[model samples]
Target chain A: MSRKLLETEGPKWVAQGIITAEQQQRLTALYPEEGRVVGLLPLLGSLLVGLSALSLIAANWQGLPELVRLLLLLGSMGGAYAAGEYFLRRGANDSLGIGLVGLGLILFGAGIVLTSQMYQLIGYDVTGLLAWAAAGAALTFLYQSRFLFALTVCIGGIVQGYSTGQLSGFSYFTAALTVGGLGWYWWRRPDAVLGGVLASGILWQAGLLISFLHAKITWFFIPAMLVYAAGDWQPDRPAGRALQAPPLVAAFLFTFGLALYGETDTYAGLLRPPLLAYLSALLAVLALSAAGKRARGRLGSLTDWLLLLPGFYLPSGLALAVATLVVLYAYSGAVLWRAQQEHNPDRITLGITLFILTTMAAYFKLTWAFMDKSLFFLCGGALLLGLSWYLRRAAARALPPKSE
Target chain B: MATPLPLARRHRLVLLAVAVQALFIIGVAAAGYATTAWGRTITLRTAPVDPRDLLYGDYVRLHYTISQLPRRLWRETNREARPNEPVYVVLQPAHGAYEALGVYASKPAIEPRQAVLRGWITNSWRHGLRIRYGLERYYVPEGEGRKLEKRPVLLVKVSIAPWGQARITAVNALAK
Candidate 1:
């Protein structure tokens, strides 16, 4: 489909009478060569010029008068925005324009910090930097650029971090703004890459909130699962799955850790919250997620929740460790079965990797003390190779024959 | 997907956003100026700093005398002082500098000679509590940080705005 492909393969098609030489020429003409290399020259030139200006300002920053410093901050920020707008209006170099806009957003944050430092001012609350996140969200909406959306997510994280780490208070307002402003944007747009970015950003904030409250880390899942439930409700399948990936990965890692360390009663004790309250909150989120899956006819993915089973509730012993392994095996097995049914090669690879990982964990936990070291290594390596070969063969057989 | 806004609308919105940002930055600068112009100034004494601690960067790390207080000075009787809890400290000018009179969970009424400053409890032990006033770091001009850091002790002048904002107006080495 690319010009390069046609340029290389067109002759063969013409020689075989699949198309005439003239037709091949027309087909090749349909895809024009991009001026990507030429475009880079100007981008590089501008970058060098910008760097020179930055270093110069940084060198003279201390000697500059207060008003001049303020003017410099404002002037550079305004220049970036104006140039962004001009490029956007020209309707060429869209990435360059958006990059400049992103720069402007960064400068706005720098402006806030520098201005405060200029007067040796200290704000007890997040009100000063909150404006930076607000501006990011507004620019994201106005531009409707994924780049801006991602930038805003990062700004939200930074603001929350500063609030909790420096001010010793969590800014609920900033958290809500990110979830509402960017969440609404993602809801309407439903892009795969943006969905992943949004979900991960929200998860990061959720983790911070958990740490801020000093709650038992188990409380993290309540908000994390809420994010997963939101993804289940998304109408776009791929985008929804992308949003769900982070929470699922987090859950999987937690469960895997539980498997590896569940033999210790102390660690398991730390994981247990007020059992009834935690279960009720988790159940409510589960019901919401189930309803969403059912509504979208994606009930098959309900098995993804297998990793969230509260196996730690079992008294820590051999029984607890064995139970966790069972859960891991069941979850990875489900992935393999689902991948095979859907004939998705990528998922098949993922499923195989997960299956092999669980096996290694199981082997290490069950056999390390009892088996001889050399024999253990030999058996483990052989088992993995054999499992991989068998899975790949099965996957090959499951796929429909290739047309080409 | 929702359609993007028209070019004219987009341009206007972007321009408006940029203008608002510029204004917000200026407003921050104004707040800084106003804090010094309209607020009450109080002088705080910094504890001696180990020379090695000053080697980090272009900012001098100041440990104020009021950063730590005796446990009995915590005025809350109903419950214990918790770490990271924001508390108001009443300071009365004693000797040559303001010293902590009491630490309260809520803002306590102060007499004409006393002032209340807010700080977060960083740590608490059997005998005392450590508090941070968000005025610990004094950013200095390039190469000047080292000069300031070499001083054994300093007197930091802070302007506390009526609205609860505070800032370091000046830091001077305490005369022996």
Candidate 2:
């Protein structure tokens, strides 16, 4: 309500000269909701198409014939252009719709050109990947879809860090930049999809960074703490109030806690980052949840379970592995719970990443151990089954009970 | 609410621009590649000099093959060699492609029977090619001068042509 008022009120204020031209531009560009039908159409359409394209690209990894892949990538852009033309001719060129479709085509085309050119040069080297990704991001800025823009840039940063053979430093930097920069940008305007994109990138990037950069755990907490502090003041809009802040706060605090427990550091100040991060995130999410519990009379969102990740970590090797399994289970549980609550794709993705990471970690652990490999396998298998059962129970419990 | 921008058109334009640029760059690269691989090239043998880079590592900056003035061009000019003087050289028979001819001094005021080659010589005791201008030295890899074996190895002559064009021709390798 207040958020809606604030958003509608903002443009008027700017028109009245209350806001500077640049501020007005930035704010308006941050969240464009015009082109009602067309705007809505492409965003929905692109969601499916984009996902398919991404899956296909990922699936062909390592096995893709370079020449054929290049041609297909380029051809995809051409198809997108034709689609855009059709939309334009069909009178879907409303400002918002045009912007959305334009953005989609731009992304599709840029993705093709860059993928081919970059693959040609470095065979998917870090520099080329980052460059192409940055180019796509630049397109995002032009199209004013920070959600996609932020995602591309974050992925680019991760690829760059991966290229450097270290996931911690570069990934952290890119994640922080993408998350914090876009987070702050969208926070002012508070678009749901854009905010979700920012949060997702931060979660994955931070998770990956922590997994790699265990040497300094405290540094991970800085942004988490900042995000928590920022999420304190709830925005008036539905997009900002209910969706964006809560999950971000939960994920950050959870990751920070995990960083504190799992990462080994001798420095006395090492734990402060995670401590501060977790506390702030906890405060923000709890504050939001309390508001809903008090006023809305609804159960707390399962996103709060992100906090369990940090709390479950243990120092003992066997205990730590068990706790990791627990955290992964909790992560999946929270995603499923959120999916049931909101029926959003974001939740689905969170669930998927949790499953993938869990499977990868278990595989790595099982394959690397020397003696007692059988025990490792047995225990890991037991944990997987146990977690699967727990998740199934959690999902079943989340459902409304059937009448006896 | 305003109408959305037609994304497809904008995307096509963007792709077109990128593709054009890529094609242009590749074309230039191909041309250079062809010239290096198949085209006739005269080698200028030279010795290596030292150069340093702050960020990247140091390298031995190599000198050229035709490092000195041709004796025939020098004697025919009838002008005594002077120190710190610029010279100009011209190719008599134009090669199939652009080629670097050795350096000489100024052209004669009166038309001579033969081309007045103005090759300059330093007043140094060794009577060798002087390092008058080093920024323009063209270098090729060592032992790649099989084509230049028939032609006289011209000295590293620096010339100021009639149109103020400066060229160094007849490059020879410095004796190690």
lDDT winner among the candidates? 1
| Colliding residue pairs in candidate 1 | none
> Could you give candidate 2's per-residue lDDT for residues A337-380 as a string of tens digits?
66667655555556655664566565554454563778777867
Which lDDT tens digits does candidate 1 get at residues B1-176?
69989998888888899999999999999999898988899999988778668645657788889999999999999999988898999999987889999999998888987888999999999999999988888877767776776788888999988887888998887787
Which candidate wins on DockQ? 1
User: What's the CA RMSD for each of the models?
Assistant: 1.9, 20.5
Q: Tell me the TM-score of chain B in each candidate.
A: 0.95, 0.35
Weakest 10 consecutive residues, lDDT, candidate 1 chain A? Answer: A261-270
Single out the weakest 10-residue window by summed lDDT for candidate 2 chain A: A116-125
TM-score for each candidate, following the candidate numbering: 0.96, 0.35
| Highest-TM-score candidate | 1
- Give candidate 1 regions above 4 Å deviation: A9-21, B51-57, B142-150
